[model samples]
Target: MDMMMVIYNGLLSDEYIKGQATGRIKFYEYPPTGDISGPYIVIDPLGPPQSADYGDNIPIKDDYLYQIDVWTKNRLVTKELSKRVQKVMRSIGFGYFAGGVDEYDKDTGIYRDARRYRGKAYTEEFEI
Candidate 1:
């Protein structure tokens, strides 16, 4: 495996897209709260990727497109993994959604609100 790829997987590389593989977004369901779900990924059980230490003299390249390809593959798998979660949420009459976030205000965050409810009852669903 490429050293850069290792760094990407370790989530230490600046070139890496954080949380791109596991796409889970905060969401809620109002009204009857019947249930709703969205796309997700599924990871297969397998040993870690083949890797070997490539000392300090490492190289990075623009032609290193495999990183993006691998990320895509991983994302697809992760989407499959999300099936289990969707099933569980549906069973409980909840909602499930996933996506990337550009920013967040964690300190004073208003997570979920029903657009039809006139913002009278806001609920915060913590990530489990």
Candidate 2:
């Protein structure tokens, strides 16, 4: 489960994601303390990975559910970055795009698009 975060953190380093996000791409869901403003991304696992497939009663694969959040002041950037993130997620074998929902922080006036994805371990992207 923890390794999935590492995989996502490693795979989301594409140029589109890097260029659009003005802030850091953190591993946790919560935003960092203080005002490190501009567009940012947060990656977090929903829960423990579910065991799938069995080989001699031993688990052979695991299903993972993860959430990727895009936060920004601009709606366009949020939407575009969300797509770019989906692209990256697909590239890493996260074929299950569970879609996203719009969220706003009234106090900060920041827009967020929270997207969910499901993938399996031992796939092309998840080597471990």
TM-scores for all predictions: 0.20, 0.78
Return the lDDT, model 1, position 111: 23
Q: Candidate 2: worst 10 consecutive residues by lDDT?
A: 119-128
Local accuracy of candidate 1 as per-residue lDDT tens digits, 1-128: 23232323333221122344333221221212212233212222122232222325432211111111111123333333333333332343323333322222244231221111000111112112
Error of 2 at 11 (Å): 4.4
Off by over 4 Å in 2: 9-11, 32-36, 97-99, 123-128
Alpha-carbon RMSD to native, per candidate:
20.4, 3.6
* lDDT value, residue 13 of candidate 2: 74
Model 1 misplaced stretches (Cα beyond 4 Å):
1-73, 97-128
**Candidate 2: which pairs clash?**
none
Q: Number of the top candidate by TM-score?
A: 2
